[model samples]
Target: MADLNTQHMIDEIRDNIQTGDTLKTKLVLAHLPDVDMKTQNRLIYELSRGDVRFTVPILLYLMTEHVSIVDELPVIKETLLSNLLAYPELLIEFLSDTSIKDKTHLINVAGELRFEEAVPALLYLVANSQDEPEIKLIIETLGLIGDPQAINTLTDYLYAANRDLIITAIQALGQVGTQSAMHRLAERMGTDNEMDYMILSIFADVQDPVSLEKLNDTLASHYAHMRIYAKQELVRIGAKAVPALIDNLLQDDPDFVIHTLNVLGDIGDESAIMPIRKLLGKDPKSANVRFAAYEALALLPLRKGAYTLTAGLTDPEDHVCVAAAKAIDQNYSEILTAGIKNLLRPKGDEARHIAKIIVSAQVDKIFLSLAAEDFFQELSLVYLPHAHKDTKEHYTRLLVKHGFDEFANKIQGGEDVKNLVKVVAVDDSRMILNIYKATLHELGFEPVLFEFPASAIEWLQNEKPAMVLTDLNMPEITGVMMAAEIRKKYSPKELPIIMVTTQNETNDNEAAYAAGVNKVIQKPFNAKSLKAAMDEFM
Candidate 1:
């Protein structure tokens, strides 16, 4: 038997359900905990009769909080499903409601049901609505529906002025994941716009053959940014893109072929080996294509490719030779040892060139061998101090061990040269300082390295070095300010200052010169440039 209070609560809920007021329905729901199970069952049976007004809240409560009610009153489950399916207008009407909360709840219901019948109404709302939250949810619901009819509607919003809506539309199209949808996304990549990266990411996710072909076409795009975006997407697509990438390599376009080679290398798939080798055998005249093929072959790591890489060692282009040698160094170090032994024999220039390639790459490692005496003599013809200090020391030690005492002494004895120039060098990057250290020592100057410009400036007050090398960009004090402070005590002739910077700031360069800097060298400089700048003053 139900208690009188429970009976009264049931009567009040029934009246509220009849009134069809959301607030009254909520008030009835507030008293549900105090009601008996019989009263709860009575309330569910009364409300389960196709009442669209209580449909969302009841379903939300049943789905979230009162899930066990489905087991107790199994008819309620069937009723909720049947009512939602029978009356799609209820959800459609909720979509136009002013409350975002109510609209969001109905959108979730539409997605949960995956009701294709609701797609037309959802599309209508998305087309007519300018509210971001409503449009976002509506577009999201269409993605969950994944009906073909929604594709054009979603694609139209891809170029919306609101970036959030555009991104949401892109994601929705990715969820659609149809070939037509993918082609639509790929069509936007022709322009070098801000959306290229986002489009590339979508392509990477799609990974369909159509998307692969489109991305390959982008590799030949005149815009470098578009080509880069395509290349990165191809690499990200990885082995899935291998077949299409190989097909593109066969095209007559040299630029496309070269970019395909690089992408194939980055993918590092062995399947590209034979095709790349065929290209190398044909001996394409373009050094770019040849170098790209060499790099791709190196990454593939096939034993037969060693001959081609070795042939590249004698190529006229220094970059090609270095690329081939680095490939051998990373993948085939033992080949270098064999090449060194071949140098000992009375081989032709090919053998000597191969030996030089091996020595340039593995100079620190191979110089330790007894056969390195001839190689060391060959290396001595050029100053190879671009390596770090520890590597330079190792190479110097190897030269001394192999009986090139005079050559080794000349390199290691650079400090004893007449009036050994004391150069103060400051940079925040330890890597750059190490490069400077090796370059300065090679140029026969003692470099005083400081990671901080302030400390370098303080040291400059007392000691007068032959020159000061400082980075234009520093944390504590910029190179220009430090040079200005140094100019107060000494003239540019007395203390020549060289400023190295990575940024191409012509105005800053002018300012630095005005602040007493003798010369400014841009970053990515080599030993020759550093030596040239030092020779200008020191």
Candidate 2:
């Protein structure tokens, strides 16, 4: 038997639900805990058949409060999903309700039930809602439903004026993971650096050949940040990315080869070792390729990796030699006993130079001390003649400390060296070019000015500037096209490029980025903003 208050509350809920009084119905439903199980079931059954204006809230309340009426009554759960599916018009009405909390609950219910019939209504809410929270929930629900019809609408949201909406839509599309969704995401790659990692994560989930190719192309993107994201995504894909990476390695592009080697090294799989070794053996002239391969081999546990790294110590490039030495020091410590002595033996000037670098990096104190003495002796003989006054003095102190007073007496000094970073600025407007020149000079950079985009490209072919800045709307060659051409020869890490544009159009910005523009600076930018952009890439 129900208590008097509990029976009165159930009677009030029954009467309000029949009369379509939503507030009174909610008031009574709120006290459902006071009712007995039999009365709660009767109240739920009666409410399920009433107007959705009355029933939707009751269902939401029951679901939210963990009311036993929903769990103990199968008819209540079925009626909730059926009413939402049976009356899509009511969902539209609820979606249009002034209360955001109500709309969010309704969207969640529709999504939880995967009511495909309600997708149109959900999309309508997404299209019209100005509230970011409401829009985010609607977009997420549509994705949870995983309907193919939502792809185009979700893709449009990818360019929403609000960034959070764009990010939510991206995550939703990734959940959709449909072929169309993935293709749309791939098409939008490189549009924004901030969004690249999220988009690459989506692509990795796709795990198809097209996605693999896009990930591979990004490995050579003109933005170091994008390249890093691509590499991380590739490694996250793990063995899934290995075959495609290997296929790309067969290409003649040195940039592709180097990036693939790096990705393989990051993956740290032994399967890639043979292909990388073969490429290294074939491309002896490419010091970059050899360096990447040696680094990749060092990441593996193979015994041959130690010998390959040791051979890298003899390479003429200082960076390669240093990398090899560091790898030997860190990963191949056992190689130090025989390898360090073999490297130290007098072979040639380059060999001796590399040997000194290796011994200095060794962990063994005896080897390090002996190697330091030999290195200082060689340095005194090589640099004492042309050393600056301060450098000569510093070397004299070093030589004296090592008991080489004779060499210390011969020390002389020269002027200090200053290395200035070079930047190229191109704009059709002489006024903007002057601003660029003045600003760059004040920032301690040497600026090369070009009024013509063609001439800028020509100069870039001969002299490699640290970074390039160009206006978007050029006369003969647009900044984007010039950037594309430049990217053909130099990777983003090798040469970074930024575009300045008065065009606020999304298409123009997207086109510019697609053409390898690393960053975009809008018109009327000040020295502060320009310096900030330059600093980001430099």
lDDT of each: 0.69, 0.70
Task: Flag clash pairs in model 2.
Answer: 388-413, 388-414, 389-413, 389-414
lDDT of 2 by residue, 469-507 (tens): 987755446787789999988888889999976544465
Residue-wise lDDT of candidate 1 within 305-325, one digit each (tens)?
464455667776544555566
What lDDT, from 0 to 1, does candidate 1 have?
Answer: 0.69
Residue 450 lDDT in candidate 2? 95
Query: Worst lDDT window (10 residues) for model 1?
Result: 380-389
* Candidate 1, superposed: residue stretches over 4 Å from native: 1-9, 15-46, 49-103, 190-194, 220-233, 251-258, 330-356, 363-391, 395-538
